[model samples]
Target: MTTVADAVGWDGALDALAERIAPRFCRPEARRRAGQYLAGLLAPVERKNGWQLAEVAGDANPDGVQDFLARMRWDAEAVRDDLRGYVVEHLGDSQAVLVLDETGFVKKGTRSVGVQRQYSGTAGRIENCQIGVFLGYAGRLGHALIDRALYLPQAWAGDEERRRAAWVPEAVAFATKPKLGLAMLERALDAGVPCAWVAADSVYGADSVLRQALVRRRIGYVLAVTSGQRLFPGTVSDWVEDVPADGWHRLSAGDGSKGPRLYDWAHLPFRGAPEEWGKGLLIRRRLADGDLTFYFNFAPAGTALKELVRVAGTRWTIESGFELAKGEVGLDQYEVRSWTGWHRHITLAMLALAFLTVVRTAAIGGKGPGRLGRRTSALDRAGDPSPAPPAARPSDPKTRHRYCLVALAKTSPAAGAALSLETPHPNR
Candidate 1:
């Protein structure tokens, strides 16, 4: 059995990445500690807080590690710039998708920077948490978080005393989540990080400024919007109801854990764009319940429906990337409170994740994973052991073929078992 460490030069890869960003740190001690800090994040430490990280780094106390985060002289943005270059060098794609989203970090007490009562998707409800807007790159090679901004709520941004205590810079001001996302997107574009499409949920889609900016850039997008949002003439839900049966196409919006994310997809094109640009409302219906979802799409004329579906599907890559980073690289395990501390820790963790992404990409022969380090297989298409027909099977060829494969597996257990053994289950 080949372990991940054996397949990728794990230590050497980390060392090379550490060396690549070494110039970001001023003092030799800060440079050395930064490397150690990154290693600690990549290590199998349970909590990944400062104390635990220090113990893993063989330091007597947490002072050195804590100082490295709080009082370090290095600029987090400089290291972030290097991180972007590293990702683009290894995973760049001209048709790549730049995904913008936010994740919440649950925190206690009143003093933690940006911590307040808010709705956290991580918690599934309203709670005291901090939100961080992040930009991710999904390409032919793989996906990883490339840039991040800690979202400061209106309360914290206005409270002068809290801002002083938390070391929030004077230039920092209240910016909505969409604004933060737009800033990060602009940074990625200015750096020439290759991408053809942008994907986001309704939070950013509702921002006309962001959408118009993408339009001016000549970049394409598949941005989700609320069903109630107006689409020039009527609500999006109204438009969805007007689509006839023949307009719908059953397609696989890329593969998921179970198999292809089979959905009923259709779009209503908008007129008045230049000859080169196409605009429309893309709709997706659930096969199980016929529930509807909507997206605002902007692409070059003659772009295939399947191509838009592919761009829409790429949105999941950032979600899976977040899970991998939090699960495998301790992306949200930091215990920092100050503005500087948060950025420093997050940047180091992202670097660790980028290293893993590059190594896994190489191991998988540059055939990108459905999620980072994990690829979908024929076994995924082999549904249940008993091969019962789904309640609502679409007439699409891909959907029909999936059922056939399931039936074949049931009829030939030996062949199915052989196929299962030939393809390794992904390591969590």
Candidate 2:
């Protein structure tokens, strides 16, 4: 019997995601059915991978199913975009931040898409893996991953021999993580999401291309910086008169305006800077918690340091995002292997995470996830059970889907921050 549940079906969420993967890639109904089928087929303890995921998602013959998935134009980015659209629509024009970070997926064998022996944040050591540079956003309504680019390895770029053997596309070139990050910021901007800023760790913050691109695009950014990084504004006169870099620049810190925070400027042109770069105020904030430093080339001098700190702090959302995504959800498990399969699985896992984030935002408020200080009686070896139903997806075509992440934020951590989502028919 063909059955669609009367209440919510986790797979049912896919039915609304037309903004993402074209229906032709995998019929939403079929994909949902395949996913549900797989969910039931896998043992409770089974890993999350395509081999197992395909068992139920597969057709009468397993090989044909494998071939079909590989051949499809679909990739995890498509689903991630779907989840992004859903959450953004729900948010409805509140200020939000998109965070960029690279995650490593460990692979023992050769031939996983973009896998190489490299530094993996997940493993905290050098290992064979594919590094994924991703962009995520969260605000009053919810949070979701928006875009992804596989870190095509330098090996593929340097070796024509391996390039030919691996069929690495000719366009692939040696790009540092920051370069990939710049492209992602551009992608978010191009999508026209209502973003106030971009955030990331020192890896991206230190890269000149990333900071320059954000400045060139006039997109604001906050990123952690290595203590050694230098920043300063272009030469300008004092508040009283136009002056050059040989002048003094200082900023007062704290409520009393007497805090130790201060910076001195060395005015310079965009010339000595990195490519496509503009020169601006550089702030060096030293504190006991840790030393923080960065440069803001585009913002006005009066606001430069504040903007830098705000942008730099935005990285926490993704850091908290990772904490919830990995610990609360089973993101670390590798129950699948195909390039297509791994992404597909991660996409679904992200969907669930997005769903919960929305719930927490709507029902309560989701600023960012916070630790409870100890394991809660609320959590267990069994994964967070599904959360209660959310208000219907918002009706505005501009923003209606991402109740998925609300599911994650709502279920376990309980959205420690304020959720700005409006209730459905509050009058009733």
TM-score of each: 0.84, 0.61
lDDT of each: 0.78, 0.50
**Model 2, range 364-405, lDDT digits (tens) per residue?**
542322210111111122244423322221333222111110
Q: In every candidate, how many clashes are there?
A: 0, 43
lDDT of 1: 0.78
RMSD of 1: 16.2
lDDT of 1 by residue, 99-140 (tens): 998888998898889999999877789999999889999999
Best-performing candidate as measured by TM-score: 1
Q: Best lDDT goes to which candidate?
A: 1
